[model samples]
Target: MNKTIVLACFLAVTMIYSCKKKGKESHPEVKVVFKKKQVVYQVFTRLFGNTNNNNKPWGTIEENGVGKFNDFTNTALKEIKDLGVTHIWYTGVPHHDVITDYTEYGISNDDPDVVKGRAGSPYAVKDYYNVNPDLAENPANRLEEFKALIERSHKAGLKVIIDIVPNHVARNYQGLTNPDGVNDFGANDDKSVAYRVDNNFYYNPAESFKVPVFERDYKPLGGDNHPLSDRQFDENPAKWTGNGSRLSQPNFHDWYETVKVNYGISPDGKKDFDELPEGYENEGFRKHFEFWQDKTVPNSWDKFKDIALYWLDMGVDGFRFDMAEMVPVEFWSYMNSSIKTKNSDAFLLAEVYNPSLYRDYIKKGKMDYLYDKVELYDTIKHVMQGHGKTDNIPPIQEGLKDIEHHMLHFLENHDEQRIASPEFAGSPDKGKPAMVVSATISTSPTMIYFAQEVGEDGSENAGFGKPSRTSIFDYIGVPTLQKWVNDKQFDGGKSTEEEKALRDFYKRLLNFTINSSALASNYEDIHLYNRNNTEGYNDKVLSFVRWSTDEKLIIISNFDDTNTYNFNLEIPENVIKKWQMEDGNFNTNDELYNQYSSSLNIEDSKGIINMEIKPLESFILKIK
Candidate 1:
C-alpha cells in the first residue's frame, strides 16, 4: 500500500476535532503535514538517566543506580525532539526477569540461574501485562508511571515505541498482572505431548530443564551468594530454547535465558494453524480481525494479540518486534492486521535480517518496516572498515527498489556494535560520511542509538555482555552518555570539545534530513554515472540525486578517512532533460557546510559539477 494512501486514511479516521471560532478574524487554521522521512531515537531504558559512575562488571542494582520512568522529564524530551527525533523507542520497558526481588508487590522471585545478568535481558520478557518494576518510583504503580511517560512523550510532540518480544519469554514464564479472562502462556498446555496445535510452548516430553554450564570466569549468579542461585530451575518438561535449540541443557552461547513460544508449528517444521486466505494483503485489519473471530487458532496467537492491544490502548504509538523472523509470519499477519484496525498509523517495525524473507514479512506479515541490516548496514560497515567499495551500495538500493521506503536504516541499535567502538570503526568520525549517505540514499526512516551523537564507545565489561555493544543485560551506566546526562541536566555540559563537535554534526545532519523536501521525495543513484564519466572519481566516493516537484539536491560523500578527492561529478543528459534544465551556468550551495559554493555548467543538455570533498565529509548541494 502507498504511504500517502495510508496517511490519508489515518487522518480521515483521527482528525475529528475542530477548533471553535470565538472571535472575529479567527486565526488561520493551521494545517499539519506529516513528513515522509522519520527519525527514530532508541534509548535503553535502564541506562538512559542513570548518573552513577560505578560500572563494575557484575555490579548489583544498588551499586549502579537504575534510571526511573520519571527520568525522561519534559526538558529532556524536548531536547531529544530538538535533535530531530520523531519517535523515541523506549527499549526494555516490559516487565522482565531481574535479579532484584519484588516479592513484596505480589511479584514472584525469579531465580538468578534463569536470568541473564544483574538486570536480566530485556528480550527475556517475564510478564506481558505489567511494566518493569525496577523502572518505577513505586513498585505498586509501575504501569501508571509508564502510562504517564507515554502521555508526556505525546505532549512533547514525539511518538513512543516499546519492544515486543513475541518470539520468546523468560524461561520462568509468569504473567502476574494479566487482565481478567486472559490466560497466561502455556496455561492450558498438555505437557505429555511434544507437539500440539493449540499448545503455547514446545515441550521435551521426558527431559527436565538444566542450566547451561558456565565457562570462563562467570557463574550463574556472578558468584554472588543466594539461596535461589543453586543452578537449578524447576521444569517438568523442558521447552525449546529461544534460538530453537531442543537440548534440555542449552550451551552457554545459546539463548538459554529464554524459552521459545509455540505458534502451532509442529516439530517437523509444518504449520498447523489456519492460514489467511488469498488476497488478504489488500484487505484492511478489520477484515482480518473479523475473519479470525470464529476461527480456531493456536492459543499463543490470542495471548500475544491481547498483549499488543493492551499496550496500544495504553497510548503506545507502536512496537519494535525483537527477532521477529523466528515467529511464524502468519501470526504477525493476524496480530498486526488487528493492530492496524485499531490505529492505521501505528509504526510497526521488525528485526528481520534474512533478505529472502524481507518481502514476505512486509507484505504477507502486514509489517510496516524491517531492519535494513544485512544489506545497507553491513555494506556501510564494510566500507567504513576500508575493505569494501562504495560501488556496492547502488546495487543494494536497486535490489530493494519496490520496498525501499519500508526499510529502516541505522548504524547502531541495542544489538549492534557502536560505531566508535574498537570492534567497529574505532572512531565516530568514520561514521560522518556513512551516516550522510545512509540518510539521503533513500526515503526510509533513520535511527540512532542513545549517546551515538557523542560517540559512546560501549567498552565496559558489563557482565554477560562484553564490549562493543552496550550492555543490555547488566546494571551499568554508559560512560559518554553519562557526561551528557550530567546528573539529569541533559545539557551535555560535561562533554569534551570533540564530543560536542560530534554531537553538533549529528544534530545538523538529522535536522536537515527531517526538514528537506528533496530527501523525502525521490531518489536517483548517480554513482554509476559519476564512475563512468568522471576520470578521478574512485570507489571511495559516492554521489546521488534527490528531487521533488519544487526542489532538487545533489549529495556526495567521501568515505575515505585520510584522503581528499577533487573531481568533476557528472549529471547524465537524460537527467538534465528530465529536469528541463536550460543550457546555462547554475550556482550550487552546500547545505552541509553552508560556506561552500560551486558553479555547475550545463551545456548541450549535460551538466558538469565540480567538487573538492574533504576526507570523511559530505556535501548536500542545492541547485540555485
Candidate 2:
C-alpha cells in the first residue's frame, strides 16, 4: 500500500479510538449493582438545612427565613449518607417564580399574582438554565453554589436527583442564560394558531391571559403592598394553563402560574409525530433513542431534551419527574431514552398515579421506577390507620407481582401528610410496622422524606401551607428538622427522646435493606397461609418471606397498636419446602437489632415459631 493511504487509515483509527475514550470519560462508571434495591432520601433543598426557628404565617424571607445551597454543607450530606441512602433527591433547585426582587441582578420581576408564595413553588420553574437565586448567599453565584452542593453530595457517597416537571413551565418562563441560538419557549410561536406541532406551547388565539380572580379574601403576598401585586398579569393570546384549563381567566384553584407545553398532539387528540412500532416497549433505550434520531418530533420535545442534557452535562445523576402521567408516555420514551444513552445508570423515577398507565410508563417510557401510591402505599396507610385489614394487602401484592420491582414504595413524601400528624396515624411509632412492610416487602427502591425519621408532623400553620403537609410554596423552617440540625451541627443534639428513638429505628431498618441481598431477590406472602392455619393469627398481622442464595428472611409486622399478641406464628408447608428445610429445630435471630431471638421448629416440613409481638412491632427473623 502507498505510504500516504496507509497514514490516512492509521489516523482514522486513532480518531475513532479517541472518540470512544471521550465517551467513556463523559459518562463515568457510577456505583451501581444491577437489580439491587436502592434507598432514596428526598430532602427539599431549600428546607433541609435551615436552622431558623421563626415560622410566621405568610411571612417574608426576612421574617420566615430560608434555607440555601450552602446550608447543605459537607457535614449535612454526611449525616444524610449515614442514613443508608444511595440517592439524595434535592428538590427545588431550579430557578422558579419568586416574589423577591432581583432587578439589580438583571432578573425580571415576577408579579406576585403569578407566584405561589413569598419563596414560590418549586414546580413553577422560571428559568430552565438557572438556579433559584433565593438558594444562594450571593444571587449572582446561585448556579455555582448548587454545583458545589452537587459535588459535596457526590463526595459524601450520595447520588443527586432533581425535579423535571415535564407537563408545564412557569407562565412567565424566561431564558436568561439559554445557550446562543436556542429560542425560549413560545418565542417564535404563531399566536394566531391554537395548536401547532412546531410551537413550544398551546396557545389560545385572540384572547388575553388574566391573573386568577381572588376567591374568598385571597391576595398576593397576603395582601402586602408590592408594585407587582395589582391582581393583573399581561399575556396577549393567552396560553393554556398547566392543568389543562381552557379559560383565559383560570379559577383560583387552577394551576394558573404555569402554562402547559405542547407535545405535537393536536387539540382533537391526533398525533402530529411518528409513533413507535408495536414491540418498542421491550426494546432497550439505545434502540428507542436511535429510532427517534431520524424522526422529527414536536418542538417541545427538543426543548425539554436540551434542558435535560444541559443538567446531565452539569453532573446531575438523575431526575424525579413531576406529574409524569400528564405528558404522553411516548415523550418519556424519547426523553428518557436520550437520558439513558448519556448516563446509562441515570435513576429515572416518575410520579405516575394511574395504575393502568404504570406498566406503559415503565416499559414503553424507559422509566426506572414509578410511585406505588394507588396500591401498596394506599393499602399500607389504610391498615396502619386501623381502617383496613392485612387481608387487603396479599391481593394487591399478587396483582402487582409481575412488576413489583419497578414499583417504588414510600410512606411519606412532600405531597403526603406526615405520619405523626393528627390527620395521619398521630404517632411516629405507628409507622414502624408500616415502614418495615414498605421498605422490605418488595425488590423495589424505598424513599423517605427529609425529617421523616425524626417525624416532622407538618402541623405548622405557615401561610400558603396549612397543617398536615409541608409547604413546598412558602419560605419556612421545619421545626422538627431544626432540632436535628441544631444550628447546622446536623447531629440531632436537641431532638427529643422519642425523636431519637424513632430515628434510630429508621437508621437500623434502612441500613439493613441496602446491605441485605435477600431483600432484592425472592419473595412469598406467608400471611394468607398462616391466617388459615396458625393457631393465633389475626387480620392485623402480616407475614412474608424473602430469600436468595446468600440469605433468608422471614418478616412479620403487627399493625395492632394497642395490644401485645402472643401467637404461634407458622409458615406454610409449601414455603418450608421452597426453603429446602429439613424437619429440625433452627435458632431464629432478629436481623434488625440483633437483640431478639426465638426458636423455629420445622416439623413435618412446616415451620412454626412461638411469637410475642408487642404493639406496632416488626421483626426480621433469620433462621440459622
Candidate 3:
C-alpha cells in the first residue's frame, strides 16, 4: 500500500458516510417490510369451469361436454380468489391441433393422425394470434371470449397467466388472424437447406413427413372413419420434430404433432447470432433488453416475440413457458427482457428440469422464476412414499439458498400425477404435511392445481391421457372438481364431507401463507437440531422457523400417516437468541389451526415447547 492511496480511500469512506447519514436524516430510514407471499392457482382451463359430470373414455365433445370460456362466471372467479391466490395460470387457452371439424368457420380440420386426441395437446400450438375455438361458445368469437375471461379474472382480484410454448409449434401452424404485417411461422422459410439462420423451421429436403406407426390397441379416434384420419400427412419437406428428432417418421413417443423452432443455432452447434457479451449474465433485464434492441435475430425469434407481445397487449399479466430448457437461453433473454419492458411486473416462470441450468435461466435469461422439481418436489415425493427421509430436505434448501426465492414450489400441475391418484400417495390426506413444508419452508412462491384442494384422483382413462395424470388431450370431466362446481353455483354442495374438509384445510393454509410477512422473509431449518437433541423426534417429522422483524413462527409437520407424535420439541438456544426470546413461558397460538394447545417454556437460555402432532398434521405456532 501506498500512503497517498490509503489516505484517499479514507477520505472517500468518510464522505460516503457523511452523505449516507444526511440522506437518512432527510429520507427517514423506514423499517424494512416485505410484501405478502405469492400464491399461484394453476387451473387446466378446459376442465376447471366445466359442470358436466359425465366422463366417458375417448368421448367426443358432445359425449363428454367441453367447457367454454363463458363457464368461468364471476361467482366462480370470486371463489378462487378467496383461496388467497394472487395469480391464476390458465393452461390450454391457446389454439392447437384438434380432431373436431370447424371448416364452416374457415378453420381447417386437424388430421387425427397428426393430433393427440379429440380435444388436443396445448403444447402443440396451432395459432399464436387466437384462442382455442373449443373453449369458446361461438368459434368466431374465441379471442373475444378469452379477453372477457381475462377481465373477469382481474376483477376478482387475481392476475392472469397463460402458457407460451416457445420451443415448438403445431405441425400445421396457421395464422388465420395475423395482424396487418405479421406473417405465419414458415411463410418465408427457404426449404432448400436443412439448416439456415433465418429459417423458421429446420427442414429435411426431399423427405416428406410421415405419421408414426401406432401400437396395438392404440389408434387415433379409435380407428373411426374420417377423411383426415388415414394416418397420412402432407409435408413436402419434413421438419424436425418438437423434441428435435430429425427422422421423417418420428417414434410414437416423440412429439410428433409439433415442429421444432429455429433460433439461429445450426446443426453443427455453432451460433449464427451473436453470443451474449462478457459479464452479461450479471446484468438486469432492462440492460438485456437494450442489448438486443438493435441486434437482428432469426425469424422464429421475431415471430415468438410478436406472439408474446400480442398476449401481453391483450391484458395477460404474465406467461408460464413450457419446456423452456429445450429452447436456447439467449432467446429467453430477448423474449423475457422484451416482456418486462412491456410490463415490468410480469410474472415470467419457466420449466427448466436440469438443475445445472436453473441459475442461468433465472439470472441470464431474465426469468422471474423456475420450477423446483428436481430437488424439492422429487425429494418431498419420495418422503411421502416412505422411501425418503426428512433429513434429505434441509440440504437441498441450503444448497439453493442463494436462489431460493426464485424457486416456485408446487404439489400438482398438469404433467404430474395427482396427489390422490393410486400411483401417488394413494390418498389426499397424506399430502397435508408436505404442503405445509413446501409452502412455508422458504420464500418461494406456492402453487396448487385447481382441484388439488378437493382431492382430484385423475383416475379416469380419458382417451390419449391415461390414469394417474389428468388428460390434457381429450374431453373429460373431473369428478372431484365437479362435485365442488355444483352446477356452476361455485359451492361444494355435492362434495363429500371428506372432500370439503380437505378443501377447508387448503383454504386455511393458503390464506395464512399470503397474509404472513414472515413467510416471505427470513428462514432457518431447525429439523436437524430437533432430531439430535429432542427426544422422540423421528425422521418422519420436519421442523423449521420463519421470522421477520414483526412476527416469529415455529412450524412443525408430521409425515407419518398413522402415528401420533408427542414430544418436547426443542428450539435451540441460538435460535431463541435470534428471536430475542426470554427465558419464560411465552404466549403461543397455532396459526394453522387452533385445535391444539401449545405451551412454550424457556429457562436458562434454552427454549422448549411441548408439542402433540397428529398423523399428516402440521402446526404453525406463532410466538406472542
RMSD of each: 6.0, 6.8, 5.8
Candidate 1 error regions (>4 Å):
1-35, 282-287
Candidate 2, residues 1-624, lDDT tens digits: the string is 333233212211111111112223222222222256789999988887677778888888888788998998889888888988999998999999988888899999998898888788999998999999999999998899889988998999999999999899999999898988788889989889999899888888999998888798777788889987877789888999999998999988999989988899889999998888997775657768888999988889998988999999998999999999999988998999899888877889999999999889987898889999999999999998899899988888899886787899999999999999989999888899999999999888999999999988998877887788888888888988999999899999999998998999999999999988888777899999888888778999999999877788999999999988888888888888888989999998998889899999999998889999989999999988
Put down candidate 1 lDDT per residue, 128-152, tens digits, no spaces. 8998999999989999999999999
Candidate 3: segments with Cα more than 4 A from true spot: 1-34
Residue pairs in clash, model 3: none
TM-score on alpha carbons, each prediction:
0.94, 0.94, 0.94
Q: What is the lDDT of candidate 3?
A: 0.88
Q: Candidate 1 clash total?
A: 0
Model 3 root-mean-square deviation: 5.8
Where is model 2 more than 4 Å wrong at Cα? 1-34
Q: What overall lDDT goes with each candidate model?
A: 0.87, 0.87, 0.88
